[model samples]
Target: MAKKETVWRGLIAACGLFLILLTVSIGVFLCYKGLGTFTLYKHSVWEFLFSSNWNPADDFQGGGQVGAAIFIVGSVSICLLALLIATPFSLAAAIFMAVISPRVSNRLLQPAVEIFVGIPSVVYGWVGLTVLVPLIQKIFNLQYGYSVLAGGIVLAVMIFPTITSVSADSIRNIPLQYQEAAYGLGSTRWQVIRRVLVPAARPGILTGVILGLARAFGEALAVAMVIGKMKAFPTGILSPTNNLTAAIASDMGGAADGGEYNIALWTMALLLLVISFAFILIVRKISSKGVRER
Candidate 1:
């Protein structure tokens, strides 16, 4: 028994160490490759981060003007919009599934949602391209439908299952005694949910939201298809734009190995890594606050 226990513990420890090592390795690699762009091209990090001009044409063969401000803004806008669209629906679904309609949730709704998760991103993109894009254009009387709005809508659908699943799990984990206490205090079901359940599950819900945001930020294929891939600052939600992930996907292949363009792509990847880390930190902070409140 001791030997088996020791083996299992070692295996778990090894897995944890491997994950840590992998994360550190990726961060180091991105920093090295990303910083190389500034050194090789003599471009200021400030310009790369703040400037909207992303003209890699001149730098195709060598170092040229490369700025990612527009892509960064577009990425932020799309993610914000997606969260706005998804959060309310996801929360409602979670509440219904965990509190109001467990039988239906288990028998039908969860399976339906799982099906959505199983569908390929490319299929979602294609549907957006063929259906949502044209509908948006026609309704809004725009020349093109491929815009930030389209991307946000598509991304909302993609992250819906993630947010809903996590939130449902969080709500379901709430102690039954909490609900009974609320009822004893003359609280109704809705009131109990609003005051007791939601507050208790807040940390987990926030974690789910952040995870969904990460998915929205990192998504490449689906957003790329509907966002028009324009290398400019988004003037409005209706405007066509590009994102960091899309820019990397579309431009990386054309860049020669060890070239300025390649390095610029690496820099975008580094920015993505930074954004992901920030989200993780935010999750930790929320978790800590929840513990303190308890």
Candidate 2:
């Protein structure tokens, strides 16, 4: 029995180590391929990062200016806007589920949220394309509704379930003693929720927000359907633009292997990987803080 347990533990440890090694290998591969755009092509990192003039389709080797500021701005704007639009509604739903009315939540709301999570991203994009796009165009009087606003709205809906579920779980995890104490102190239900429950669950809520943002940043096809794939910086929220993931998805196939364009797309992929790492670090920090508080 002892030997069997030792073997089972070793097998699990091996699987964990394999995953770590696989992750490291992928990172190294991306770094090697991504850095070629600057290192091999003689392109300066500053121009690649800060400049907005991205004309990489010269059908040649070293190629055109590879500025990525436009994509970066588009990604940031749409994701932040999505978070801004989604958070309040998601939080309200979470509070209703976890605090205001738990019975109805388990029966109706929770399953609905889980179904939303299971819905394909393409379905969201399709709905946005057919329904939201025309509505936005009619309301805003634009030539087309493929803009940052459209992408943000679509992304917001896609991430709603994630934020709602995480926040609900966080609130539900709060100790019963806290609520009892709040009520004992003559606090109303609303007051207890606002001053006690929300404060206690803030870190977990933040983790969910960051996770949603990370997903928004990585989403490509759904965003591409609504984001117009414009290679320029958006003048406003309603203006058309493109993001890193969309650009990579659209251009990577046509770009020649080892060419400046290909490597630049790879560089954009590396940037995304970096963003994911940052979010993970932030989540870990928040989780540690939450644990210490507990």
Where model 1 places Cα greater than 4 Å from the true spot, the runs are: 57-63
| lDDT tens digits, residue span 1-294, model 2 | 999999999999999999999999999999999998778777888988899999775344676889999999999999999999999999999999999999999999999999999999899989999998899999999999999999999999989998999999999999999999999999999999999999999989988898899899999989999989988889999999999999999889988888778888998999999999999999999989999999
Error of 2 at 248 (Å): 0.3
lDDT tens per residue, model 1, 182-204: 99999999999999999899998
Worst 10 residues of 1 by lDDT: 55-64
Error (Å) of candidate 2 at residue 17 is 0.9
Give the C-alpha lDDT of model 2: 0.92
Candidate 2 residue 210 Cα shift, in angstroms, is: 0.4
**When superposed on Cα atoms, how far off is each prediction in RMSD?**
1.6, 1.2
Question: Distance from true position, residue 54, model 2, in Å?
Answer: 0.5
